[model samples]
Target: MGSRTILSSGTKTEQVFGYSRAVRAGDFIFVSGTTAMGPDGPVGEADIVAQSAECLRRIEEALAHFGAGLNTVVRTRVFVTDIDQWRRVGEAHSARFAEILPTTTIVGISALFDPRLLVEIEADAVLTTG
Candidate 1:
């Protein structure tokens, strides 16, 4: 087994929930379901597009902790509060992954931990080069 590295965003939720923001097991890194969680509250509140982008942004930040980037991603799972707004979320996803084209899935969910959160994204990445 490769060295295990745990990454933390140092958020209170992580401490309370007893989870790491991302975990690297060997060359594979798993980023937890991330949302637009801002210092004030859920960022972009009711805007799915903004929330979606923020979700990816947070995931990207987590990935960077392990010297990984979106291009290293192998798969992504998106959860949206409303399925009808999938196109808006897709735009954000495509903007980051147009070239890499990681396998992805988008699903509609009832609600998130916070009512203001509209989207959550989880990612799996493999370090290919270094």
Candidate 2:
């Protein structure tokens, strides 16, 4: 067993929901489902690719906080409101993890917490160096 740490994104939803954005236990890091919510509101507006990119970016930020990166990711889960828009969302996701190609799952849901959010992503990573 190694050190454990909690990482927060400082979003109201996190506090309201009583969950951290990510948790690091030993050499593994688990990131919560992330969306593209911005200062004004959900990002991407109506573009699934952009929204997906934002979600990945948020996940990367959380990983970086704990000295990890996308390369360390072992798995990812993506949830989308529309299955038909998978191509665009997959393109955005591929741009980030193309080289690493971590195990990934994409699913379609009826809705998200916010209607404006079309996609949410969660990731799990293991530190390889240690």
Candidate 3:
């Protein structure tokens, strides 16, 4: 078994909410739901595709801490405030994982922590040791 490690994004809410942005246990890495949050608030408030890209960027950053990348991702769960915006979010998601083509699930929700956040994405990856 490999050692466990917690990755942080240095956000105050992590301590407040008592959670790490991602955790690597053994050969698996699990990333928390990431959004388009910025220093002040959410970014790309009205653009679903932009928000989705930001979420993936945050997830990628988290994964990189453990020597993993989106190509290593095996699964992803995407949450959105509106299902109608799936097309935009899907496009953004594909742009990042077109070659990787990981398994995914997208669901609609009533709201998120911040009203401005339209998309949230989480991912799971396995270390590709060679």
Candidate 4:
């Protein structure tokens, strides 16, 4: 087995919650449920599209830490408070992953950790070597 690397987004909540924002084990990287929630408050507020975009941006940042990117991503799971807004969320997601075309699933949930947050995204990626 390859060595595991724990990656952080430098969020106080991560330490308090005792979880890494992302972790790499062997060639695979797993990104936890990422939100637009900031230290002060939510980034995109009640806008699903904005929140979705913000989530992808953070996920990309996390993937970059592992020398990977959206291209390396194989799958994604998106949780949203409103299933009706899936189209808006998909538009935001596709904007980042159009050519990469990673397998994705969007599920509607009752609520996130915060009521202001409209969306949360998780990703899995595998590093490609030459």
Best-matching candidate per TM-score: 2
Q: Quote the RMSD, in angstroms, for model 2.
A: 1.3
Evaluate candidate 3 by giving its C-alpha RMSD to the native, one decimal: 1.5
At residue 45, what lDDT does model 1 achieve? 74
Q: What lDDT, from 0 to 1, does candidate 4 have?
A: 0.91
Give stretches of model 2 more than 4 Å off. Answer: none
1-130 per-residue lDDT for model 4 (tens digits): 3999999877778879999999999999999999998777788878899999999999999999889888999899999999999999999999999999999999999998888999999999989654
RMSD of each: 1.5, 1.3, 1.5, 1.6
Task: Give the whole-model CA lDDT for all candidates, comma-separated.
Answer: 0.92, 0.93, 0.92, 0.91
Model number with the top lDDT: 2
Task: Flag clash pairs in model 1.
Answer: none
The superposed Cα distance between candidate 2 and the true structure at residue 18, in angstroms, equals 1.0
Query: Alpha-carbon error at 79 in model 3, in Å?
Result: 0.3
Q: For model 4, state the Cα shift of residue 13 in Å.
A: 2.5
After superposition of all CA atoms, the RMSD between model 4 and the true structure is: 1.6
Cα TM-score per model: 0.94, 0.95, 0.94, 0.93
**Ten residues in a row with the worst lDDT in model 4?**
8-17
> lDDT value for candidate 2?
0.93
